[model samples]
Target: MIGNGCWFEFDEVRGKIIIDGPMTTDLSFAAEEMQKYVRRAHGMFLPIQRGVLSESTQNAIVVRIMAERLATVEEDGFAITYRNGNVFIEGNGIRSVLYGTYRFLELYAGMRWLTPDHEVIYEPTDRKVWIEERHDRPDFRRRGIILEGVQSASYAIGVIDWMSKNGCDLLMMTIEFWDEHQAALRPEMQARQLRLGLGGHSLDRFLSPGDYFEVHPEWFAWYEGGRVAAQPCFSNQEGIAFLIGRIVDYCRQEPDMDTLSLFPNDNKYFCQCPSCSTQSFVSNYTTFLETVRDQLEADGQSVRIQMLAYNAQIEWTMLESMPEAASLDVMVACWGRDYRQTIGSPAGDRDERFRRIVADWGQACSQRYHSSLSVYEYYADYWMMTSLFPPLARTICKDIEEYRSMGVQEMICLLLPYEKSVRIMQEEIMGLPRENNLADREFNSETPVMWLNLYMFARKLWNSSLDEAGLIDEYCRAAFGQHGDTGKTLLYALEQQLAQLTVYNTRWFKLRYTDVWIRDHRSKGKAVVTGVSPWAKEEDEPEIPAERSEVSRRIVEELEDVWHKAAHQGAHSDESTLLYQALTQYFRYVIQKLRSIDKQSSAQSKLIRQETEEAMSDLTEALQIETEIRGWDALHFAHRLRDPNVL
Candidate 1:
């Protein structure tokens, strides 16, 4: 450690904090964070005070803003230099100032905020520390995360603070207009522009039946027999005018909004009246969109507007030429691509089809109207993390690169909150290992990599060009602390192993119905096995796949090794230990189930029953352990495991 680089004199005791001038909310937040961590580490709470330091001030830590570095550090860039028992944090903007403080906390004060509710500040017993100079800013203009699963107020604040500190500059959370939590979060989201967008699935706000449909039946869509109040008929000139009027009114109320997303409802059916039927759904949508844009421009308003090319809008056949307007960016709503493959790879063929469609629209938008494109991606699956382990982060990283290559910079993600519940079904119990009685235990567990995936998502969005291994290293180091490298290695291996499961439908994947699997990977061999069947009697069950069983056993063994090695790395708590144990046990259950299937022919009825009981037992124990570690409101929506049920 460099002695002169220390910000405060080390006496294994308290320190004084001195401020250089007036404080803004961001700066005040920085001071408070500094105060919280320093005391946490040294048992010495520093009091933040105003004005110049007096001679009586001892071991004083100064928080000062230096304007000289503004030109060098552009936008929200920041720099930190420490010398003569004082730390100086300088920034070009409020975000930079707060970021510098967080960098200081992480590098010098041993602070780590990995997840919303999980924070680690390893206070050194010796209380002797020194941090070298540092500076950084994000690469993307709109580095943000979709706050889909952040359930509570405290959790929301944690996500905001974590993002800001990590150099993220944007957030997409559709908080209700009158939500109480908005007051707490809005202030922190100042430097990072918070965007609220209405989804395409619902247009009640823009074309509400409560106000219009009761009087004008022509305003809504024509259903099987008659008109429905849900979706609007765009052909009616008066209805279109009314819709535009409502939007204008909305803009008047939300004058400070950065962007207004004018999305159609999620349903596939659009207007099919004689006037609307002449053009495709997109033509009708865009005609109104351009009119809205023109109206907004006519009114001299400067709001960036976007809408989704969603549902049937994605199908080239269902729509004509892309929306004719150049001023609006299309937020392409898409899913069903294979996550196991990268965009240019063979596994990505299904993925490439969507890419072509998106690229075509992007080019058209850019060339015709100079408007770029963005995405509303399903980064992960919700609730299914309980069984499936998809390569969520890897796929997200791949998509971001692909999107950037197409000259698309802005990406909005959809989040589905994870719910905790123990599944119960007598027939489903057969899905467990033979001789296992694990289902007797009451517990629910989710994906172990959920937090890691979220962390990588934020970090990569900030710097997509960062080396993959290096990024994983940084995340693991912060998340698992001393055991960080071990965690990183495990995560890297996990991604590879998990990808293998995406295209195969194991009996295990059948526990839940999923259409996520890409292709069948099972070898072309069929032989009867007794213990594993669709509850069939011993005569006709296909032999369990030996290769798959070997793979499962190998994964479990490797995880056990990681679990043990990670013990020495020192986790923030026993949470990591539980995670490892639970993961290891889950694969073991898979292996055990396959074994019983392999031995099905010779096993007695009682023995088969015992085997089924055993697999359930392993599953039960793992979930019981995992329940203690994972949280309820996860924003990494739809982190689904590979499902082989669908073609």
Candidate 2:
């Protein structure tokens, strides 16, 4: 029986899902997903039927590719409406249909995919569904995360599933690893309709030095005084032709590859030959891109070519000089930009340079037929921060708004897995001391803080107008239930503490190692090791300011209090409990790390070593908790603590 003013009644006995269009894989998957979620939420299996429905199918959930109706909708946009005793889900394309189904489940069923391993579903108390018409689309054309470091095939598949559930449409893997795991990864990606992108500093792979250095040395870059096998000689016609041929053959082998990146070797090494030196690296790179685009077109291949605006290629003048090509995608990499602040708010010269580079690229990409501007971000780059959690949700949201305003259509971030830690733990079981293992563990586990940043990044890329605070609260609620407010407080407190600690570290380092020393070493093209004071005598080194040490202590105490309160409230589910344990252990590790830093400045050598040992023990506990929860080891700041004397 239909109630008054009810658009559709979700009757367990009579209601059904009606597919009103040709069934594609994505469409079929969407129907199955809808059915599965409905069953989970209401203990009702809504029978799925493909074809025109009879009049008796009154209270039905209708899904179709209403391309004609969605004339103005983006290719991945969707519309959902409830009218005439039925719920209608419509999209302009197959991917949009799947997105519509997920969105419907989110809005009406209260479902959330918080992390790769965490899902929350809330059942509707009312059987009658009532909703106004709604249409939704992503603000960015390509929203995705790049898999970096080492990971298992199953882990990669889990990330893909999470991306699909969150409406992320792109999945980029480095070419070297993708070749090894594509067999197990491609099917999962195909079923979800996620775009596959392959490449990352992969020019070396296509034209390795070992293969050509002996036969044709001209193929390598001419650096300093002679040729070096760092990168391909972009100006060499023969080398360019060989590189193009290899790329075309690769595309031919993998016809399903949506994008191929020809990013140069991951360094500032560029050809210094007469031909290359006549112009900037960016200009040479642009020529290489144009040349590759021509080759791909001539070969009748449809793979989009990508290049990085990184290192020596980030010059604004060079970017401005290049002519626009519709076939080229430029991914601007933010390697050294400060993550503590938004890109729109430049706090230093480096930040301003990155901002200008992105703006210049945006202007350059605007003339292209396709949205070609992309950003290679590092929100979850564990290696860069030595495995510390980067609390940058608000910064990421504001930065995305800036990018969107600049006509940037795509964004991908580096997200590493915790497999290295798992491998180390297995070795530890064989007889290695945990402290001995800490010295080599560079990549660590993804903490809750990292997951939160990734979650907010994905959400903001889709909807730029979403409030960061609201999203944080939403994630906390989904992850912690009744203790969500406490969880939110703890997260904000941790972020504030980390931000303050960054400031403290900057001040401490500057005081100990004069800025003049850093600038002089940089000018001499020498790598200045951080935390190593240039003073010849140990007594000349500055002491840690008493105020900074006190602030550090206060931060540790505050975090410990909040962590205890949150833990006391407990989690709402089994997964939430595991997350809570990880968070608690990680919090302890952070506190100990701060203590070690504080002690290093003033305490005796023995005291400093003791603090270091305590920090390592706490980190090991956190890693153990992570392995139990995720079936893999997560890395942390153990490497950083290995030499406490340096701090």
Candidate 3:
């Protein structure tokens, strides 16, 4: 019996189906949209019926309409059933329904839902969790990569779109001014301009309290006895109103937006203005939220607001005075320092750190606000070359468990820009088995693990307690298609190497006299040999006292060993592409250490510069060699050589 709240009921005898509801406008069209799925699943057309909106219709259905809040402002309305059935699914809107339908068909084809007796045993792990959905659809899923390396809305949308296919529910954009193009939101730029306001790069362009020196300068919050550039001048009513209006306008117009993330809350310390510096951190956010609320309300539309628990502002006292309105129709997107648990291991305990941070943040924020809180785990470390898979997965799992423990309900991954990482996450998400079983095998694939990782990462936004191993197996099969064993071997080795590297990667180094001397005196102030070669000479030299720099020597030596090990791992790997990239970086670091020791001779500097150039030339050749060997473009290496020293 499909007992009822909101149900997608089908009648084979009548050759018809009815989509019942308390559904959003998008979900209300589900019955009309079922044909796509029906065609895919049963390969036939069916008439459909939709129930009228009423208490009678709402109270007695097998499935119930529910809201799964997303990180974005968009509302993801869904259907849930406490009763068992032949099949169950959840989708974003039409697209999601189509996708869910396809998933249903895939499972059907595999007889994944049928039992030995040919009876359907279709029960969700929890009756309340039959289907979970996304809050919004990405406007332009793929933003072609930008050369300047600035993370753009277009770029993020591309990531969102890719992740969406794998099961990600929501995506965030850190919007600003520069994104609008050289022109304002004129009709010409409208076609090209992203939905969210552009992300501003220069700090001066951002509306900081200190930056508001010329016009409306009186609004600055010169509170508490200190002065700083970090806080925005919320006290400046005119300036505040102008910024708030812009944000509200952006939300109203941008079709891709489901939520508008207010980046101002990232302010670490409160403003030092004599009038308001002492205000609670949360109060600062609430002030902005209230100002935004006023503007949004006036615009005659409600938008979900997402605020950050960023920087030094992340404290319990801040949450105390958060405005009531901000709490309503709002969600928490917490990011500060890093998710400690995201970096798991003996040396780096990302899991333990996550537990502590999540508990503290969750309890503090939820106690004061009536909002859904999601933990954005930082999985990838871009400063160094590494895949965020292990730490990403490990941190995600820990967050799932901890958030569940804290009675908070959502988990989101703060991904860096990497197609490979996204792919791996997808597998992890879909590979999650039918129920929550941590002991189940991790999702792995023979091909590339990027998709699997993306899938799993997205799945966390839905139900965290799903099957672990089965999902992994499913994703592995999908990613590898045929070379299952090969995929598994590659994935295993990669995981092992990453696990080993995580230890050395997180080992922080304190600057030694040698490091300082190397950067300032030797090698023409270039830490890398490549950075130093441009200024090399055969006559002049800079002097440095060697014995006084024991700290610098030790630091250099330790870092050198770490790089050497990484280099060794790369050589050991059969993947020539990954191997050479790692080796290249390791060699650069090694050359830097060597150059650091010779701070005084033009002749020695010239030799070092010459060697560095040769090494760099070798790296370029290696990249080309690997590209030829693979008979393909060297995608990873293309960016590395853009700057052999700095970038």
Which is the winner by TM-score between candidate 1 and candidate 3? 1
Per-residue lDDT for 1-647 in model 2, tens only? 11234456678887899888665534777788889987876678999988876776677888888848555568778888766678888887667878888888887777888778777773354566566677788888889889886657887898888888888888888888889988998888877788899888788788888888888899989998999898888889998899888988988899878888777776666799999998777778878887887888898988888877664323334333444454477787766555666787887776787787788778877765354889988777653443345467678888999988877889998886554433433343223344434423432436467777888899998888898888887887776666577667666776766643433222333221101111122323335322232322133323332344466567778877776776666622354555555555566666655554343223322233445565455445544544443321232223334555553
lDDT of 3 by residue, 151-199 (tens): 3445443443343233344444345423442233222222222223222
* Top TM-score hit: 2
Error of 2 at 174 (Å): 1.2
| lDDT scores in order | 0.55, 0.68, 0.39
TM-score winner between 1 and 2, please give it.
2
Model 1, residue 284: distance off in Å is 3.3
Question: 1-647 in candidate 1: lDDT tens per residue?
Answer: 11234444534344666666655423566677778877776667778877766655556666666656655566666777665565677676566777677777777677766655556663343455655666665554555556554446666666677677666665665534314466776665664433444324346776778988889989888766678885788888898888888777666665555566666765566677777888777877777777887888787777667756753423434322465554666677654444566543435544566667777776876688677577666544443333345436566676667777776766665444342112222222223323244333322223345555666666676667866667666665555555556556556655665555544432333322111111122121322121223332233223333344455556556655655665566523465544444434443333333333222222223223445445344334433333432311110111211221210
Model 1, residue 78: distance off in Å is: 3.0
Best by lDDT: 2
The number of residue pairs in model 2 that clash at the backbone is 4
The clash numbers for all candidates, in the given order, read: 27, 4, 65
* Greater-TM-score candidate between 2 and 3: 2
Model 2 poorest ten-residue lDDT run? 512-521
